[model samples]
Target: MRTVDLEVVRGLYKKAGAARLKLDIAPRFKPGDRVKARNINPPGHTRLPRYVRGREGVVERDHGVFHLPDARVAGQDDRPQHIYSVRFSAQELWDAEAPSEDSLNIDLWDDYLDSA
Candidate 1:
């Protein structure tokens, strides 16, 4: 394995730690669109949090296209897709006793969601 020295790390994070790319790919969702998180459990690296899987949320923002981290980790590079901020009510993720007015926003890739 190659060691990442300071110079290499500096070049890798030149964008201030953002992997965002300059692409014109169309987004799969938009704000106000209801979506459901796909219950996927691949036998490999994934950024999807377990608590949010199979939950419903509203698309809050389109963060543009970027390479899927999971895909990259699996050696399938070039899998670029739109990432969105999805908002879920605390009650939906937890229980009815949770505050109804409270919601949590999590950034999710297009592959992780479907129209609700």
Candidate 2:
């Protein structure tokens, strides 16, 4: 592993705290595209919400490319890909508990989703 200079990082954050990377990668899922979150159970760090796993949703918008923490935390190669805001209906996620008129929008990585 390599050491990251804290001061250098801090200097860059003087303007904004945004972690969004400027990459010219093509987005896998576009707005209005139907998608499903992958049902995964890895014994490590992940950003995927447990409740959203195995559930289907629509891509609300693409948030551009960023490093996938799952791979990095596993001490593997970094896979930077597009992250998207996906909108899931309450009925689809919570069944009968949540109101049918309600919905949830979650930011998810490309690796965590599949064409539904």
Q: Pick by TM-score: which candidate is best? A: 1
Q: What is the C-alpha RMSD of each candidate to the true structure, in Å?
A: 2.3, 2.9
User: How far out, in Å, is residue 62 in model 2?
Assistant: 0.6
Stretches of candidate 1 off by over 4 Å are: 1-14
lDDT of 1 by residue, 17-96 (tens): 37788888888899999999999999888888999999999999998888898999899976899999999999999998
Give per-residue lDDT, candidate 1, residue 30. 90
> For residues 1-116, what per-residue lDDT tens digits would candidate 2 score against the true structure?
55679977777768873777887888988999999999998889999979999999999998889999999999998789999999999999988778878999999999999999
Worst 10 residues of 1 by lDDT: 12-21
Residue 28 error, candidate 2, Å: 0.7
- Residue pairs clashing in model 1 are none
Top candidate, metric lDDT: 2
TM-score of 2: 0.85
